[model samples]
Target chain A: MSIRDTLKDIVDNVEGALAAMIMAYDGIPIDEITVPQSGFDLQSLSVEYATVLKEIKRAAELVKAGAMEEVSITTNQTRVALRVLNEDLFTVLIMTRDGNFGKGRYLLRLKGYDLARELA
Target chain B: MSIRDTLKDIVDNVEGALAAMIMAYDGIPIDEITVPQSGFDLQSLSVEYATVLKEIKRAAELVKAGAMEEVSITTNQTRVALRVLNEDLFTVLIMTRDGNFGKGRYLLRLKGYDLARELA
Candidate 1:
């Protein structure tokens, strides 16, 4: 099984999501499986989300630390979560409004850190 | 010397700041600060800012990791940079638009990591 598949399975098992997708930092879509469209502005959101991770990566370069582990955005309509997969890859998760966000966030963050070691 | 004073001096010493203040994570003003208001909101800005950190801290716990190192917000009018000084303390550098943001972000992020050692 691919890494992305593993992640999607874990998150989808939660039973309250409308849809979930893995988005790349460069606005590319990767490993997406959703029942129906969440109607999010993915392109704009990805760009804005990418900008933050790009800056964080730049900051990490300046600090000689490494790449970012995760980045997320929460809005009134919905919340988009990102986990940096590697220097060149990050994943964006889109969820329906009013889902179990706290649990989902915790799982992604913990998984993202472990993923960072592979990406590093 | 107090840590807050030191942070305030570093940002204020810049040639063209309208104002600079170090804000705590809980929307509390931690250090002495000043200036004619840039006319941008601080309280609302701070609360929104704090919410992000609170979430990040909670994620770190689930990850069994340390606290956040830094966070920042870039707006059309201005930028608010937060560096996690310790679990209880963080520094908010509010700088006017058109200043040297890249340089300032690098400095605060670098210093904030160093300060974490002192904090731990």
Candidate 2:
């Protein structure tokens, strides 16, 4: 399946998932998908999250904490999961506030590999 | 108990917990603690995380995602959980890779109020 198709499938199968995007570390979107009625600005969000991922990578390196594998942000309105696929790319998923974080994390980890392979 | 005492108690009680810190939104450490033998750098990590918290808050604001309540980063060697206490302060906890994230999250939430009150 194409990367975009896989991202669409993920959003379709994951309950409460609002959007998903494959972003570069430099704040650019490679591929993205969002539930049509969800009303999320995936473009702006992807850029903002890419900045986050870059800062996290720097912080991890400074602390000798090894590379950052994943990050999850929980807010009053939503949960965001980020998985680093490689040095230059990562994926971000946005879900409902009460969404299944464990399931979201699982799917991101599972699909990250496939995405990485396809990108390679 | 004093905030320092409470922080110490948390590390002492939570298994595999390496360190904890209370930091201002501007990347200042208000109070912090680390396990004697853990060899973790709470000072640097706290500052780095404060920057992260700041950025996440900004991103959430731009995206209109309401307020950011918590953020968790899982790496190869540790799990770091961050809870925003108020507009000016937040708490960060670092745990061993195998530590219980649920317990860590629970403790931060439980103590966040007390710390906020004391700071006020």
Candidate 3:
């Protein structure tokens, strides 16, 4: 299966998931899948979030905390998870506030590797 | 107890804990505690992280995701958790990569309210 397909599987299986995409640390999208009426601009959101994630990734290294593996952000209306696939790439899953958060994380972990392999 | 004492209690109770602090989104610390030989500058780390976190908080709002409640970052040698206390204040916990992350998170939830109440 392709990267896009894997992302689709992730969004389809997770309740309330609106979008999933592979993004670069520099705010570029590699591949993405979004359901209609996601109610937000996934690309722009990913870009904004990438900038912050880059800062965090650098901070973790500066502190000798080792390479960042994952980041989870929970807001009142959304829960987003980003899992590092490589030094320059990470997979992001955007879900509703009431989405199955645990399952989203699990899918990210399980399928992120497939995305990473395709990139490699 | 004072905010400092509360921070101290959190660090002392959690295994491998390095530091805990209450910081504003603008990078000013309200209160903090760090054990000897923490091996890193907690203030500088928090300051840098605060900047990134502020961006994230704003992005969440911009996307209408509602107010960000929590963020967790995991790396090779350390794990950092941030819990929002209010619009201006948030609590941070830093621990070793192998620290009792679960307990650390629980403590933050239980004691963060105390810090928030004291601020009010």
Candidate 4:
């Protein structure tokens, strides 16, 4: 399936209460199909959010001579952030409060691996 | 110069009061030289830290159809987290409380790009 199609599956499966957004690691919105909308600052966040990924990539270089996987940020603000690296790409999602935070993360990761390989 | 050497220069420059550490995004410590060593959990944290990077890589894929840059995370705990991607590497630094959070980050990025190229 195409990448968009895969993303659709993610958002659809999440259903209502779960807001699905594909952001540019920089926090720029890629494509998100949901209601109630997300009021996050994707444009600015996209750039700032990237800092976390950049550092993680650095760690990977040293250990294993370069073999790193995923990284995340958890705040008391009811938001859980995860960053997955695929080549030179970054995929980020901001799960709404009602979103199945744990399940959503698991699914996204599964799909992420597939997407990464597809791109490769 | 080896990546380690470059890092040593960074720690030395940062000097006293600034605690320097090179940790895997997973929170695992790579190597850190300082008088008062940091007492953070590297083993468990390493795996968790990687999550942030993974989600970011996902974001990059969706936007620009696959072009992404650095990602960062900032906590009010006097600790600023940065992720600089270098090809297949991940470099993460937990800057000391007194470290030039901004400058340390800048140098890391410049060095990150160079290191990425070197590894490649």
Question: Highest TM-score among the candidates is held by which one?
Answer: 2
Q: Which lDDT values do the candidates have, in the order given? A: 0.55, 0.89, 0.88, 0.53
Using Cα atoms, each model's DockQ against the true complex is: 0.05, 0.85, 0.77, 0.05
Q: Every prediction's TM-score for the first chain?
A: 0.65, 0.96, 0.96, 0.68
Q: Per-prediction TM-score, please?
A: 0.45, 0.93, 0.91, 0.43
Q: Ranking under DockQ, best-scoring first?
A: 2, 3, 4, 1
Q: Over the stretch A31-84, how does candidate 3's per-residue lDDT look in tens digits?
A: 899989888887679888898798888777775667888899988888899999
Which stretches in model 1 have alpha-carbon errors above 4 Å? A1-120, B2-4, B15-18, B60-66, B109-120
| Model 1 DockQ vs. reference | 0.05
Tens digits of per-residue lDDT for model 1, B3-108: 5555666566653344454556777765535546555455555555555566555543333333445454443345446666765767666665567765666667
Model with the higher lDDT, candidate 1 or 4? 1
What tier of docking accuracy does candidate 3 attain? medium
Candidate 1 lDDT over A19-97, as tens digits, reads 4555566767655655455554444555555655565455434433333454444433444456666647776565544
After the best TM-score superposition of candidate 3, give how far the Cα of residue B8 lies from its true spot, in angstroms.
2.9
Off by over 4 Å in 4: A1-120, B15-36, B63-66
lDDT of 4 by residue, B16-110 (tens): 22334455545455554443545544554455556656655554443322333444443323344545454344666555445565576667667
Over the stretch A5-29, how does candidate 4's per-residue lDDT look in tens digits? 7766776776332344455544455
Weakest lDDT window of 10 consecutive positions for candidate 4 chain B: B62-71
The sequence of per-residue lDDT tens digits that candidate 3 reaches over residues B1-120 is: 898999999999999899899999989988889889988787678787798788888888876778898898988788899999987899999989899987998899899889889998
